[model samples]
Target: MDVRSDTALRLPASDVSPWVGLIGLATLLSYILFARSFPEISAALGFENDLGRLSGPYSALLAMVLTGGAMAAWSVCVEKVHRNPSTGIDWDRRRPVADVLNDSITKLAGLWATWFIIAGLYCLGRWYWDGAYLFAMQVMGAAVVPLVLLSVPYVIWIDRVMDDPRDQSWHFGAMLIGRENFDVELVKKHWRAWIIKGFFSAFMISILPSGFAAVVDSDVTEIVRDPVRLGVLLFELLFVIDVQIGTVGYLLTFRPLDAHIRSGNPFLAGWLAALVCYPPLAWGVLGNILQYEVNTADWAYWLADYPALLWLWAGWLVFLTAIYAWATVAFGIRFSNLTYRGVLTNGPYRFTRHPAYVAKNLFWWGSVLPFLVTNGSMVDMIRNTAFLALVSGIYYWRARTEEAHLLLEDEKYREYWDWMQENGAITSRIARLLDRMNPRKGMSGAVQPAE
Candidate 1:
């Protein structure tokens, strides 16, 4: 068997790298030490001088940072091990920290400048109904929304530019963008088909959270505030982490009999869809419960406050869903190398070639609907709508860039495009409607029929 195939088939070593092991050990030690002296730490930090209150939030934050750091370190180690041993991975030794700092500052400055412009617009609305609630919403929309949206594109750019040469693969490229070569025709051909698949996949994955909400009677906030509910939340969070790590390991090691066929790694597209939808769904459910539990007059307050949170949450959902859907369709089209994965492509794919993108837009809108309708604030609605538009525009740009690359890399994609055009399967009025509804503007207007 080829080396890549062999590596894929063999199980990853049960033993982690020494560095990872040490980091894990250190994290555990730190947590333990900190937990033992929580009272002292809380007192020093001037946080109520109560260990319990401070411990949960403090430990959770620390754990998140440590866990994130360890994952980054682990990725680095894996890349190093996979590199050729003879020459070793070359370092950009001459690259200075100052250069990196400058680049980061430039990106941040641009992001902040855009944010300030939005803030000015939001301020215009606030002048009419200036209040504490409006102020809070304005702060969040102006500051947090821009920061998160900016990070999404920046991260994608960074990943492509900074990815290790050795880890570059057809699969990785497809995963990052819709097509490895970035062929618009090929993407148009398969977009709707993938969207149908993604929608069902997303719908199925949403069952877990839905089930959790159905079974749990108490409000999520109440539950979270309680020790047991908090514990359950922690467990759920840990489970997600474990699932993601395990999925990565599985992808690295598992080689199916056919290389052309992509495995449905739940962690990749499916899990991502779930993660995007579940939190807001959970929060929405919780909000409902809280609304019910509280007095009638207080309902407006919770609704307004919670929906603002949901707006940000929805923004994240839309962003992640778009990326995930794009990756899924791209991977299936490029890596699977299958002409047709069964011919019942009449649902999502029938509308357009890229259904996942469509679904992502819907998901975002769904998350934000509660906030928009509940707040009755045109400012919040317009701000979110604009942000969504910006997101879509960026993704469209990314799609176009990827399509160009795909046309060059994959000849099959050309045939796929031709077939789609010939068969009247390329685009539809419904698809165009969906595309227009997409926050991303200036997407391709022409749709080719599938041959």
Candidate 2:
């Protein structure tokens, strides 16, 4: 047998796996670094001593990294078994389920070791920064332990259902970088169990405090005195409601693998670039370099100058949140970041391929208009604009990455892409503009299909 095939049949030596050690060390060092700078991080994000609000999300964030890193290690081991095979022994071939279970247990043990070490280091980091053990214990017990337990099945299921080794496989790209296997039926059936493991967990942990703060700030008894403030408060309340509905809709309809071809890996550069857009990760060192606050000096001061426009801003916020919530609702349970659930051709998706992302970015730009009018330094304005552009670019990257995965995995996506090319509201307009500019010879002669 070829060396590749040999690697497939033989089990990986988990103890000698270099990546496990490396990941463990890296996780330890990163937590230490993040810990050392936790105070600065909180201050930069305007939390300071009020870090209590962030503890839950931050713990979740750390656990995610730990789990992702461990799962990546498992992928590395399994990927070798898949190199250049037709479909390396999945359960369809009647391979003993016990053997598969044992293999999963072995990989899980190795990954668990890495996670345990990182959790310990994270606890130490938390204690070192705040001189508090309560949060540290919570982080360890609540986040790390649960993630490890979750990973046990996560690792097993991927191996059990997705051990097939089709060349040019859907998972090849993601597997190269150690991503969990893609299995639509498995996920669709079991997704309820996963609602908490994914974005829902973060959303739940983060949104509650914001909702509470909105309630704390608002005085519903005297709404007429400041209609603008009232409008803003109502928008906030509605925004929270919209998010809750959308999040639940996402979990309820969570059919992640319905059209999943593959997905970007956490270890990939694409994943890293996309990850820096969100908080906890974005609030740290990586974001320090890439992130720039808009010149809100304009927004803060301009809001007073343009009282009427405050209503407009509030309206935009409400509209933005609504459209976003609508888009998520459209996705139903399939809504997620960086994974293909399926092609959504109805609802907001029919008008444009990326209604949610486009609307979100537009809202950010419009909402910061007050800031845009401020008398900030020219360089500051440029930096802020550039940062926003970079942020936009990251989202663009994510859209394309997801498209690539879907297109590679499913022919249906290609058909959808073609249909959108011809008839999509936004894309057709762009295509016409491009055609007009380029004026390709003979292209105009082709009969256009009626939408």
Candidate 3:
């Protein structure tokens, strides 16, 4: 019998260096910690404490700049991502302004028109004017003038160095301008990318202030006495890290740092799976329609009588949350849903293809303990567990679609997938177990990046 070595498999070469994300993670943590303790620092320095704590939405917004700037600087100064062919930037092939003027104008026209359409959609979408989204709409509305004004010179300058000055946006511009030829496919691509940015960016920005405030204003004095308190605090902190870095990833699609969205996931199934997990759709499905918490009490309530078990369960939940956060950290500045900026094979990804999904599902299971219910109804127990399982299944579906998209789009992802199947410490074991159950089955199949 052949024996497999006990040692861990060699991690595949990561398309994204872990350093970029790690630097961002470190910078983000530094800013968050400083924000958390700003009041004390202000008084200690003999400065007026009029501003109180820097835990507001504006502060949270600034954190994105600090963390993203750190990652971008590292990608440029250290990794030299600008020179990578993937960036589509050719610094050596600069053309005179006159040559690219018309092309730049077309691109600018396309971009401005795209932004205007986004604004129109925002107006039509009732969700944008209500609740948390109000802040996001306001911020975006405030920036429309500046963005339109600034696009002129910015487009002309960048167009000069672009190897192919007529990109997807340019195609869209050409269609509108009516003088130049444009491809229908490229126009679709432009909308796909912009739609992703407009939709997800607003969602991300909307949720930022609430979580940041929770962390900043949290009174942790009782945390030591109660595992529930500690767990909630840690969970909020980890999520804040995820949202802050993730927002930056969505917003900073600049070509200079080579962090631009190369392609949005073209698969309709991919979009459906992702969209169902967020916003108006989720508010209906996951929030109410399929609400799994109907008669369920959390791990804390179940274990309130047993202090040891409560703490243990809380710690487990926190560990899972940490894993989820680490998965985002690994992506660094390239973290976004429904798009392939690059493949990541480092950090928690070295362990599994979808650490965030796994961790998130496991966290829900541990914290909710859907099996145990306060109502003690067999019906409730069965219903809650079943619904949670369906929720996990949704994530599994999302992961499969994402893998299919990536495998088709990039050869690098194929190598990563195969490597994980054979050598990933956790993934390999899981794959083998699944194979045993369904011997004829494979993990995931490749499909179109878009429809």
Report how far residue 381 has shifted in candidate 2, in Å. Answer: 4.4
lDDT of 2 by residue, 31-81 (tens): 434544556778888874644332333443443345334434442464342
The global Cα lDDT (0 to 1) of model 1 is 0.37
Residue 297 displacement in candidate 3 (angstroms) = 1.0
- Residues forming the 10-long window of minimal summed lDDT in candidate 2: 252-261
Task: Give the poorly placed runs of model 1, Cα more than 4 Å off.
Answer: 1-250, 253-351, 370-376, 421-451
Per-candidate TM-scores read 0.28, 0.55, 0.93
Q: lDDT of all the models against the reference? A: 0.37, 0.49, 0.87
Superposition-based RMSD of candidate 3 using all C-alpha atoms, in angstroms? 4.1
RMSD of every candidate to native, in Å, equals 17.8, 15.6, 4.1
* Model 3: lDDT of residue 178: 96
Supply candidate 2's per-residue lDDT for 13.
Answer: 23
lDDT of 3 by residue, 318-341 (tens): 899999998988888888999988
Off by over 4 Å in 3: 1-12, 439-451
Compare the candidates by lDDT and give the number of the best one.
3
